[model samples]
Target: MQQFAGNSCSRQEMDELMQYVREAENDQLLHSALQQQWSSLQPEEPLYPVNWEGMYDTIVASPATENKVGLSPSPIPLIRRRWWAVAAILLVAAGGIWVWTKTPQQKTPPVIAAAKDIQPGSSGAVLTLADGSKVVLDSAANGNIATQANASITKRDGVISYGGKAPGVAANAPVGQPLMNTLTTPRGRQYKLVLPDGTTAWLNAASSIEYPVSFTGKERNVSVTGEVYFEVAAKSNAPFVVTTPQQQVTVLGTSFNMNAYTNESIARTTLLQGSVLVKIRNSQLKQSSYILEPGQQATGNAGGMLQVRDVHAEQFIAWTKGYFLFDHASVPDVMRQLERWYDIEVSYAGAVPQREFGGKLERNLPLSAVLKMLETSKVHCKVEGRHLTVLP
Candidate 1:
């Protein structure tokens, strides 16, 4: 991907950075050296007699801050901080032998042409009409696509909307098949849908949601595979129900997120508003259900009791806002998400590294940038062709 670090740094920005370096007790001093070394001060940074020539000179000229530490002889000022820094300095000063061994292969640019192959996923999905006709939404010009007796299906602005005449018959007619359509997203895509009942759904990558073209009965029901976030429209007479292969979630016009990826062992339903009844379908014991309040989640497999827990709903919904939020998430778990959105395969050269990460990254960044950030956590990555290899 394109590695971009501006060549210019403003005076105020540089001063603020100098303050950060001075106040980090020199802990973040060398940590930030790479950036300081790579970036040049803008004409406005007051780089005069010494010309802001070297990062050391800049540090030497910087005013001592509250977190300043006393230091001795050192080429890189930061090596004077912790015991590890002392060892680093001793190794470097011993003959500078170890310095060359830890080369920066991780931050180097990827094969640009090959790197260009990995771009962010966009809004898209395959909308199947009641008759089994499919519409490639991204390629289909935004407008009306299909019309049924009770509703008209329209695609506009990456969203599919159902609007038309009122319901004629219940979608859950037990006598015959209901007229339903499926919205599906492949590995590298996601989509949004507005149900005939005015319920909104945000489908994540490699996910699908099947529902009637129009709600006819006493309840609005839909079945989801993979992951989907729902904003159910409240109808006092009709409760909304979402079913998955492993579990079923009943909600009363509340907003919630349901993650039922087939690859995962547990299906999780997180509620943001309104209460939800989570029922386990795989349980061999007595039929049981768990009522979840706002900011709560229910997770379990088909054969186990659904466990209720508290969670930060924002983290679960960040994907809908274009982010990859990981809270103590494993490397493989992160790779799985990356694989889905970047549309690439991931392989391991050695034993999988046991690491947990906590942070947030924009989903729109190129594969290389994400890998570069991952490398900081000691997870080395190399992208070639359409595959990414994680090295131990």
Candidate 2:
């Protein structure tokens, strides 16, 4: 307790302390004892900068407490015991050792003084009309932004939707080529879209999706890059098909997330609510496919066969829900996620650390706040300008 109060506890010690706290939270006697202790101690704000909410949530969602509870969308319950837990965190951070060390294993370079802090990403995207025109949704007004051949493009509360007939144009007059519109979310931003067929898509940062303004053919087809989550509107007559660089996913009105970033070695399609058939698009390999059910994920590479595995599907779509979840993720994997969302460059000082990270953090946290958490896990790094350097 004294070491924790002085912020001198190591990561393992902190883990043990957190375990004890979790036990107390569930035990009537320990709960009363902790509450009495809280009353005797004076509340003091942490002198060192700390992501209080992130720290609190991480502790409560630790594996010892709730194995996969962190992935759920349910809000954390508020109670009196939680207050004392937060107060204990503040006390820990108030100690001098919370300032961090210069050691290789726990180095935390002063980010604010050394460089500008990168703010978290927000809702933004670019809408490319068929005529080669573009509208920046971040700055565009919340109303009808453009008019296509058979649909009116409208932006409402940050969501771009295609609906309604163009003025002076008959809805059934489209006897020509279907107009296509592409929605792209640059790094440091994301956007949601409603397709002409009523299908909704949530595009992650550095992602793009192209589809027609109106569904004309027997199949509703759209090609994508990077990651996108879809809640396909039920259309029994027309199947919804998504084309990626490495695979094609065909669905009949279901919810799924596709991670097909060109930089990633493998493309993953996680099924959440409905069934999806994942087919390898690589020509060299014999055309093979796998059908994914809810709670299953299909993973394939450019030159490999599709493989199915059971997974906590919620983890794959956590970005759409505003959380970053790392389940036994490597250093490179975690850095890749940060690189896209924070719009920063990453370079290592030596061989990459072989450690695996597991936990959840809010996507809205600043870069420095995230780095601070990483340092606690003994993954040291330094930030300069828009670049992040992983130290040995």
Find the candidate with the highest lDDT and give its number: 2
Pairs that collide, model 2: none
Q: Any runs in candidate 2 off by more than 4 Å, and if so which?
A: 1-115, 165-176, 283-287
Q: What tens digits encode model 2's per-residue C-alpha lDDT throughout 154-217?
A: 9999998887754323346466557778999999999999998889999999999998888867
C-alpha RMSD of each candidate structure in angstroms = 11.5, 6.2
Query: Which window of ten consecutive residues has the lowest lDDT sum in model 1?
Result: 94-103
Off by over 4 Å in 1: 1-117, 166-176
> Candidate 2, after superposition: displacement of residue 278 in Å?
0.6
Ten contiguous residues with the weakest lDDT in model 2 = 95-104
TM-score of each: 0.71, 0.76
What is candidate 1's TM-score against the reference?
0.71
**Candidate 1 lDDT, tens digit per residue, 114-206?**
233378888999988777789899898878877765677888888999887745344555554457889999988999999988999999999
Per-residue error (Å), model 1, residue 81: 22
- lDDT measured at residue 389 in model 1 versus the true structure, 0 to 100: 83
lDDT of each: 0.68, 0.75
